[model samples]
Target: MTAYILLEIRRTLRDTTFLVFGTGMPVLMYLLFTNLGGGGDHDEWKAYSMVGMAAYGALASAMAIGTGIASDKSLGWLQQLRITPLAPGRAVTGRAISGSVTVLPTILAVLLAGALGNGVRMAAWQWIALVLLLWAGALPFTLLGIGNGYRLTPQATGVVNVACLMGLAIVGGLWFPITEFPQWLRSIGEFTPAYGFAELGRSVVAEHAPAAGAPAVLAGWLLLFGGYAVFSYRRSARTA
Candidate 1:
């Protein structure tokens, strides 16, 4: 299991596109936005952009980790692993572990970009808490990506990933606050994982407060996706 996880990490790090999308794009967006706003001490704008960039990082991480798994499965890598001594659960565990490992660098890159370029500031403890909250808030999407990758064909998985990211970014206040959105849009945002994550990140970094109902919402979605992953894995095993 450790060997497999190490191999996965190595392959992921070697992927140039993954590095670019996972870290480069968020930093680029942060720089661009900061430049546009004159890079001032506008606390509200700083907070909003910081949270949004963190949410964007989460989305990017989900797509990379999830799609990599799906692509591997489609390429028969996972099938080969299944034929090995590793149990199905252990194999899944390795993937999750590797995903978490890959996600950390992206998270740090986003935070640093915001701090250095956008003038967002937090104490060391706050920074640690913010990282924890961001990861916690992202759990649902990560799990959803796993479930989707496990269930869908590689081509369809790509489409689903694109749709999910775009949909969430648009409706979840990453582009703008839910308050600025139409009533129906705000209603939709209220129920989304992205919204919960965005609010949680903002609360932690900007408000210096605990995430508001983020744990509950994330827990619900986590359960939902955890169930989906199990069911899909079982179905796939049976079919195979």
Candidate 2:
């Protein structure tokens, strides 16, 4: 299992696709927004922007990790694993672990950009809490990717992932403050995984109690995605 996880991580790192979407694009977006003076002169606003960008980076990376399962299945990696002693579910588990591992770099990049580029400041506890929450909040997307792997073709994976990710991020106010959106739009954004995830990240730096509803929302999404992944895996296993 250890060896398999290592192999998966190394393979993902080698491809560089993950790095582009996960780390580079998010950092670029952060720089672009801040360079335009998105954070403005307020420290609190800087913290808000910083947390949002970090959340965006983390979310994008997580989506990349989850959706890439389609590519792996298409490339016969699953079949290759069948000859080994890894459990049926372990393949997805390995990818989930890899996603968590890969997300660290993106988080760091966003945090540094927030601090150095945008002049945001956070205490040590705030930093730790933000990172921890972002990482934990990624579980839904990790499950989402595993579930998607079973149903989506490699050809459609890229389109689906990018569209879904961007849509959720935008609607959830990661791109802009949710407060600025129309009331109807904000209502819808509240239901998206991004809303809960990003809001949770925001709570860390803002030194507020996390949202009362975010955990429940996250739990619901995780359960739904995980159940789908299990069903899809069983069907695929039978077909194989």
Candidate 3:
């Protein structure tokens, strides 16, 4: 399991495209948007944009696990793995861990952009807390990716992954504040896991306790995605 996790991490890091788009794009977006905005509270808006872009990058990184899984399945790597000692559940868990690991660079890149480029400021502990919260918050997305990998073809997985990211970003207010949305859209965004994940980090920046609903919504998604991932993995294993 440890070896597999390491291998997955290595593979993920070697994908130059993933590194560019997953980490670079978010930082670029943050820089562009922060510069363009003429806001009432500049620091607060910068911090909010920082968190949103970081969360989006993390989301892209975590969900790419599904596309990798689909590719592995197509290549019969998953079937080959069945002969190994690693349990099916552990395989999924390992992938999830690796997927989560991929989010670190994205988070850091956005943090640096916020601090150095845009003058977004926070306490030392708040920075640490924000990183940890955002990283931990990516678990549900990883599980969702795993489930999608087991269920879709590689081509379909790629398409669906991008669609999911776009939908989540738009609906969860990652591109802007939820308050800017119409009341109906705001209500819907509040319920999404993306919103919850970003809110967790935003709470640290805001120097306040997060609303209970944020963590609660995240927990609910984690449970749902986890169960789906397990079922998908086991089903794939059996069929393979």
Scored by lDDT, the top model is 3
- Candidate 2: segments with Cα more than 4 A from true spot: 37-39, 82-85, 179-188, 237-240
| Candidate 2 whole-model C-alpha lDDT, 0 to 1 | 0.76
In candidate 3, how many Å is residue 2 off?
A: 2.0
Per residue, candidate 2 scores C-alpha lDDT tens digits across 126-233 of 888888888888878777766767667776766777787788889887777788999999888888888999879877876898889988898898888777776665
Which candidate's TM-score is highest? 3
Q: Give lDDT per model, in order.
A: 0.73, 0.76, 0.86
What value does the lDDT take at residue 153 in candidate 3?
Answer: 92
Per-residue error (Å), model 1, residue 211:
5.2
As a whole number from 0 to 100, the lDDT of residue 131 in candidate 2 is 83
**Cα lDDT, model 2, residue 56:** 74
Of candidates 2 and 1, the better by lDDT: 2
